[model samples]
Target: MTPPDLSRRALIAAGVAAAAFGPVRSAAGTEPGPIPQDRPVRIAMILYPGMTALDVVGPQALLAGLAPGSLYCVSEAEGPVASDTGLSLVATHAFAACPPDLDVLFVPGGDGTPAQMRDAALLAFLRDRAARATWVTSVCTGSLILGAAGLLRGYRATSHWCVRDAVLPLLGATPVAERVVFDRNRVTGAGISAGLDLALALAARLRGPDYARTAQLVAEYAPEPPFQAGTPAQADPAIVRAADAILAPLVAGATAAARS
Candidate 1:
């Protein structure tokens, strides 16, 4: 079956419906006013070798529409960063070139994060930018890196369920097993695909619910998984065991790295 052609232009055109709507009240008990169209919202997404592409790109795909030419894919150096799946994505900017202050700062996670947790340069960059960014966010194991950078300490956050509990406590963070968790300016999403939820929730906070709803509509963001097995709690016990076995090595490595 041919999938729907939910293109960028289609999403932007559909987003116009939001202009007619009033302000949106967010879960934080605040009403977010319309974002100024005159100024672009600066966003920097960190990239590293072995990072999960979807963890970054899923959110980027939606947030990029919020402000075109404002989303920057950055790394420690300018080059192609390879994902865990062996796909390579180009970093448009280096850490030195990234703006010191940003409207949003994002980090993604994968096999690379255990190493990144110990990377002084990468941790420093996150620390510096997150200090001034209006929003700090992560997807999947990305929150683990944030925790290692001392950003998530004392804050309630979430991550890929496999390591969510093991790592957050290492940085004095309160771990929550949820799809998304928001505490003040810090937002985190669980697993790889939860980036979509994180981005839409952030869009509602940054722009308005109307705009977010439009973006959701454009993306056809509804999900109906064929199997009720996305979560360990919901999956068959045997399947869950298999998954745990597969992830045990990575989880162990992450836990050891976090403690170290």
Candidate 2:
């Protein structure tokens, strides 16, 4: 699907009409004129059962500006794919239909990650596509799936904090605790919300800093969370214990999947 042009120029041009329609203001710009589009980038986001909604959505919302029609949501089959939260996103292309060469190949992490790790067809698809893809990336537990495909071997990567240290070694990946870990062309984001940071970093690599900054400005990506519970270090001991308890099953399942 072609996303609407939400660029700085577009927003400024629509200011009058947008003001009439709602309380929204035109996006503020950090650069003069429009952000230059170097080239059309080809991106493929994998869709599978039980993936996290924000894992893909956050990145895609920002990166879609780099590639409009070329941004493909692909799956084993073409249709609606359900996430862990029961949200459904359409997979516009099937495995066979996705292009061999891609500027970006993105995978999301979620509850179904264990099953995806064990899917031979899915693993094969990733390994095949990653060979030619310029950037291979994952958010949260999606790094486990990439590792299962034998894609992260000898690569420094990161994932959801719960499995970053424990399970990554099983798949031959050295896990780091950073929000976004970049080992050459393989970019892995820590946990879910990190996708936003990863996408902007990638935008700078793909286009330029000015372009990414403009995209960030247009989206107003400045974040101010109300709580300090985002990471284990920041969270209270009680909260960390509860969160660990919740993720225990997933860790076990992913560990088992990686070993097998």
- Return the top candidate by TM-score: 1
Candidate 2's TM-score: 0.87
Clashing pairs in 1: none
* Candidate whose lDDT is highest: 2
Estimated TM-score for each candidate: 0.88, 0.87
lDDT by residue (1-260, candidate 2, tens digit) is 44445565552232121111111111332111222243466789999999999999999888877775678999999999999999999999999999877778999999999999999999999999887677889999999999999999999999999999999999999999999988877899999999999999888887667667878888899999999999999999999999999999889999999988
Q: Which stretches of candidate 1 lie over 4 Å from their true place?
A: 1-7, 10-37
Please write out the lDDT profile of model 1 over residues 29-136, one tens digit for every residue: 332344544455678999999899999888987887765666789998898999999998899999999877677899998988889998999999999988777788
RMSD of each: 5.7, 9.3
For model 1, the run of ten residues with the poorest summed lDDT? 16-25
